[model samples]
Target: MPVLRQITTCTEPSTVVIERRVRTRDRSVDYRLEVCRRHRWLASNWTGRRSAEGSGGRCGTVMDYRPYAQIVQSHADLWLRPLAANGPEDHDGDLAAALRAGFEFLTAHREPTGVAIALEHAARITEAIAAGALPLVEGQAQVLAALSAAETLDAGARGA
Candidate 1:
């Protein structure tokens, strides 16, 4: 069995630290989960506090992770379905909104890995648009505008 411990501080209401230790055949391993309030980002570490750098920075009020995760997942699903089906005309607004959310997330987090993934996805989406693989529908100029904004932001972030 593993032991779990939690630590909280009133001064930093947005942060919660959870520690768990499990005994293995050879030794014991410790894991830590840190929840940040404002960004609602989850940071997990196998070793100690030094490894929590992945969780953005220290700011904002903490919120529940489940709801945030669900919202993000739902947005991602909604945005991806149209691309997967090559049905952008059916989901122009949705794709635009999703791209905006994704850009915000990347800007806030600034994680190298996540930024890399976003850049890749953006490139692919742009290529698809340019190739006419994804067509726009009525009143979907917002989609083009959103894509352009996201691409510009990404380029600036990358110092390109």
Candidate 2:
């Protein structure tokens, strides 16, 4: 099983929880950590310290794009999913998972020799399966063919 580095979650009441899991028991290590709104973060948002183009904010150049992409993705997902998810009542949950699966499957299979999962890749994996074909990570050409077949059925659907 994959061990989570930390689970940073925010709830309806707007509380952000950051918990780090300890793999083994050790006197120096603590397993349970809880923080609330009273918790303090010593972050200084210095507006004057930034470069002309704001290079300081781009500290992790390559990795910085994801959080921004995720922000947009989450917003888009909320708006777009209702159409796809509200299909035949029985298939509702599956609909959401399949859409997510489609993107996960795509990142698992990319064009280059090295695999890189782009946060901005809005590939409708679940939607593809929702439309009827499975996304096989064999190659790009085959994947496109499968996607086309998926779109055809999706267009024929009465609801989503």
Candidate 3:
């Protein structure tokens, strides 16, 4: 189980909740988190920081490109299929775990690049499964492949 931490930003009275869902043998147990940002200032401030830093704000870098809330919401969106099928209440634990994992990963990485990468791969894999290109039981394989691709790209860029 991933630890859940609530981090309050210094600039605003906003609380960012980090949740993580442990992976289970059941695919339905795979969870994604939803991030809700109530304050507009946070988003604007994050954008300003990214621009000032000259970092693309996408990949692991010096600054966060997307507000923490957006990152959470986006991942939730990406992981929608499972959530919808299992119902939110049924997957709350896993959702919390996934959120924690995402928060930790983004905090350590400092880049939100994984959002696009994961989203892209998720869409592709979902489509493949629907079309029978990939077996439904191989969903974990799809996730691993996506992660591997992202890591490979990151490694290649670093090597260059």
Candidate 4:
């Protein structure tokens, strides 16, 4: 049997909950962390310090991008498949997880052109998901695919 643990922290503007299943015999840990940011104003205005032109304004540098690409690659299927099956409403939790992951990524990385549109998109998506009002758009999969592909490219460039 696996041991399950959960921790929830409520801050002023955000709350994070993490759940993990540990298999003691195998010494493996499987964890799912959910970050819920309630401060729309703050999240919307959050700016990434990195310039999209690469590391330190240098081109062709494989600067590290965080959770957005990683989240898209890992959890895109979770959001997309359910939309085709029973619809996202049936899997609200999974959908939220996917959206939150994407939001985390968008907030952490600046756009290639230094635009804040990505942050706006992230905020919109997060709100839609939170309200259970997200439309089942046809292009959703394509966007996720694009993000995932970027991660692949980044990995290749990094020689990983």
Tell me, by TM-score, which candidate is best: 3
Between prediction 1 and prediction 3, the one with superior TM-score is 3
Cα RMSDs of all predictions? 15.0, 16.4, 15.5, 16.8
Candidate lDDT (C-alpha), each: 0.37, 0.28, 0.36, 0.34
Tell me the TM-score of model 1. Answer: 0.22
Ranking by lDDT: 1, 3, 4, 2
The reply for model 1, stretches above 4 Å from the true place, is 1-97, 100-104, 107-138
lDDT of 1 by residue, 14-90 (tens): 35444344555643434444545632333331223333444442332122122223322322443333223322334
lDDT of 2 by residue, 1-160 (tens): 1111111122212122222233453322221222223221201111112212312211111111122223223223432233233222234444344434443443455552111122112244434443666543322233333333333233233221
Error of 1 at 45 (Å): 34
Residue pairs in steric clash, candidate 3?
19-96, 19-99, 19-100, 20-96, 20-97, 20-98, 20-100, 21-97, 21-98
Which residue pairs collide in model 4, if any? 68-105
Cα lDDT tens digits for candidate 4, 77-159: 43323222322234454544444344444446554321123323443555564465765342343334333344334324333
Work out the TM-score per prediction.
0.22, 0.18, 0.25, 0.24
Quote the positional error of residue 141 for candidate 3 in Å.
Answer: 3.8
